[model samples]
Target: MSNTFPPVDGTWRNHYLLMRHGHSQANQEGRIISSPALGLTGFGLSPRGCTQLDTLLADWRWARPQRILHSDFLRTAETAERVAAHFDLTLTLEPRLRERHFGEFEGQSDDRYAEVWARDAKDPTHRQGGVEAVSEVAARMRAVIDELERHYHDETILLVSHGDPLQILLTALEGRELSLHREREPLAPASITSL
Candidate 1:
């Protein structure tokens, strides 16, 4: 298929479809599960999440993904599996696309994310509450995009990941400050944003 998406002015050689994984067990329980310890084995997609993906795929309107890369976390893994299987495409695990490590905030109330953003707004490199630095998340997310751009030109690739990391990536892609990540629109569960 011809690439209808416009190329970046001086970079980004591939079309990108960034998608947040479906609602997870953590989302259902209103908890923040951002660490590998909890995310790897637990907080997978909920029943509603499955339904959401089924419905989304049934009436999909966006560019079809020729390749799928996703976080290894159970939630994103499940999401990518469904998408890849539906499209008969190979699924690749990209660990750098994992959720922002919440550190001390793992398994806590989701509301605690506000505090993390507050600190992030002041200093993107701050690791208060042992949280992963916003700058670090941005760097990894950017690296994934750069690598994908270099490897896959003139194709639509889907990246399944978490909300926070996706937001930081989007902000960075827009040439904005990492500290302003929260200022970008929030990525709803299973929502897709293109670049």
Candidate 2:
């Protein structure tokens, strides 16, 4: 809720829950979609996605959350809404948790999506105008978490977002090398992981 930057390695009084958005059109068609793009509205939670959400909530074994934060992207927003409703919490949109900007790659073929990421793997800092550089995405994700820390220091925050940005954030926390950025695997829809 607070926009201020948190101290580096702030108090770990609260648990941060990271979850990937449910099944989406882009995901089904293997396209690299951005958060602001069309076709993402309500197209986020497919029938199977809804099933996954039900299963996840029914089987949730993670820590109980105090607040829910997620990207405005349809899939994430929808997913967060479902989970929040299950927990009787409000869904809050946080743009920093949005999907990576695919740049020239939005709503394209699968092969093309692969090509851009391959290039990004070779040079993580290259900004191809439309696409967000890995470094930039990672930095903003850190900013989002840090800001949460400063404001919700002792409050558990549930963050629902896309795959790439989530991977970037986890990699940053693990202190892994940047060159292995693209190698991070995707997170399952409705799956919850702690940070």
Question: What are the runs in model 1 whose C-alpha is more than 4 Å off?
Answer: 1-11
**Model 2 lDDT per residue over 34-107, tens place:** 73856356457777788888888898877789999898888888899888898899878898888888877777
Candidate 1 per-residue C-alpha lDDT over 108-178 given as tens digits, one digit per residue, 9 for 90 to 100: 99999999999999999999889999999988988888887777778989999999999898787777888
Identify the candidate with maximal TM-score.
1
Cα-based lDDT at residue 119, candidate 2:
72
Please, what is the TM-score per model?
Answer: 0.94, 0.88
lDDT of each: 0.88, 0.76
lDDT of 2 at 31: 68
Candidate 2: TM-score? 0.88
